[model samples]
Target: MSWLLDESHLADLSRGATLLGTGGGGDPYIGRLLVAEAIKEHGPITVLDPDEVDDDLFVIPTAMMGAPTVMVEKIPRGTEPVLALRTLEAHLGRTAQATMPIECGGLNSMIPLLVAARAGLPIIDADGMGRAFPELQMETFSVYGVHASPMVVAGDRHETVIVDTGDDDVRMERLSRACAIQFGGAALIAEYAMTGADVKRVAIPRTLSLGIGAGRAIREAREEHRDPFAALAEFFAGTIYQNVRPLFRGKVSDVERRTVGGFTRGGCTVAGFDGGELELRFQNEHLLALRDGEPVCVVPDLICVLDDTSAEPITTESLRYGQRVVVLGISTPPIMRTPEALAVFGPAAFGLEQPFVPVEELVSERFSEPVAV
Candidate 1:
């Protein structure tokens, strides 16, 4: 189904994206403001269902690249995403029929909406990554053989650089990361240009709506004094991410983070109120969560952190000592857990010695049943 995205839905969409982001994908608040501004100037964006698109329609995915922490300090000029889209279109000598997110998390989710409104292009309700990952090569599109090059990166100052690495997604990541670092640690990107048929084959469908729906559920639950976490779990039960559990409840004890090589890499320890400890390691996005040194959740599955009281997601960039949070383990879609997808973004891909394990299996084997929300 098609729907219109305007200011009314922005808050919910941003909130849900933040949770799906699993601590990265840039800041949702910043992305929200950018989308608000774009909508104000250009009107609401039309979100077309992936199945509704023509097989030959050209779709371009747009997103921000670099450390989430840097994006907090370095705001975009609101023109970069559209500029990146146009530059990519110019390179291909074909206009984009629609814009879509490369990842349905944080700023990238909103970036395509901003681009669509500004460019007068309808946006697709799909994405390359059902959840965000730190590198460009981690996308399902790449996993399914979509090349990342002939990509364009646009700086806040209107500088645009085109990267063409043939089918080398890793090289595309390296060159784009270099360009982003040179652009002051962040830039807008347009890559993985695909046809509607390619989108139908590889793109995770309706994730934008899923994020928005999750956010709405949380918001309405809070408003009615209901348990938002329970509402969250209930909402996901009907979705692809069916297993949602709060793995730990604690106060952050320590944080060690640094922005390096266009990425924010680090870890934090959360001391459980009942005495155990949960340690989280991240590379832009939260990749792993350990409860008393045992793996509770690992990537490909989402490891999200939400404020214990308010249920708002806390991004990696926003993690600070002493904040009370609930670490959540949500299973990834079956599509994202396949061997091909795992090879691109599994624990081994991130240099972890542990193998890829489903969050549901890990939760069942390592811990007692999750506490009632």
Candidate 2:
């Protein structure tokens, strides 16, 4: 079913996207403002369920690529995403039937809303990843063999680059990252153009609804003074997530952030009230979470660091010392947990020496429900 997305649901959308962002997808504030303004000008945007898309319809996924920190400093010209999409369409000699987000992360999630509204096309309610990952090649589309090329990277200054890497997803990412840095640290990517059939085959379906529901659950809990974390967990309990539990709750004891290799790389230590500690590693998105030097959670799964009191998500770039937080461990969607998917984005892929372990297994006692093996 298709539905109208107007100002009424924007808050839930923002909150939900942030939750799925898994600690880094840029802040949703900028994107929300952009989207609201666009809707004001363009009327309410229609969101199509992935199932509603016809097999041959063109669907272009859109995202803002590069350092999230830099994006905040150099605000978009508001034309970047539409330019990227139109440029891609001009290259392919076809018009996009709809737009999709590469992932349901914070900023990326809302970027597509503006694009779809401006283009007068519906936005798909699905995404490549159920949560966010740091790299272009980490999306479920890439894992399922969708080429990243025929991609368009549009800069804030109105410059655009069309990439035709001919099957090298990593090289496409490298070139795009370099261009984004050269363009002053931010660029909008409209890529992975594909038919609806491919989307149905590879995409993590219904994530928009997932985000909306999660956000609503959290908001209602807060409004009712119920345990927001428990409400959030309960929401996930009905989803495909294998585990939805807090890994740890603590005050940040230390943080080290650095811009390296065109990526935000850093780690933080959180001191538990009982004197225990948890450490998190990241390259833009939270990748690993450990307790006392032992691996409790690793990438390809989600390790969301959220505000302990309000349950608001805390992205990697925003981590600061002394802030109380609850680290959430959520299993990746079933598509991302498969053997083939694991080979591309599992623990080893991120330089971790250990094998990928399900978050449920890692925190057996936290979840009352039977954890999927």
Considering every candidate listed, which one attains the maximal lDDT?
A: 1
Cα lDDT tens digits for candidate 1, 205-296:
89999899889988999999987888888899889888887789999999999998989999999999988999999999999998999998
TM-scores for the candidates:
0.97, 0.96
> Which lDDT tens digits does candidate 2 get at residues 1-373?
8888898788988898887887778888888999999999999988888887899988999989877777666779788999999999999999998999998987888899989888898999999878877788777898898888889999877899998888888789888988888888879999999899998998998888888888898899999998787888788888877468678888999999988766788899999976789999988888889988888888878898889889988888888888999888887778998888887778777887878888888877553453211
CA shift at 311, candidate 2, in angstroms?
A: 0.8
**Where does model 1 exceed 4 Å of error?**
365-373
The 0-to-1 C-alpha lDDT of every candidate, in the order given, reads 0.90, 0.85
Q: Which ten residues in a row have the lowest lDDT in candidate 1?
A: 364-373
**What's the lDDT for candidate 1?**
0.90
What are the runs in model 2 whose C-alpha is more than 4 Å off? 367-373
Can you give the lDDT of residue 65 in candidate 2?
A: 87
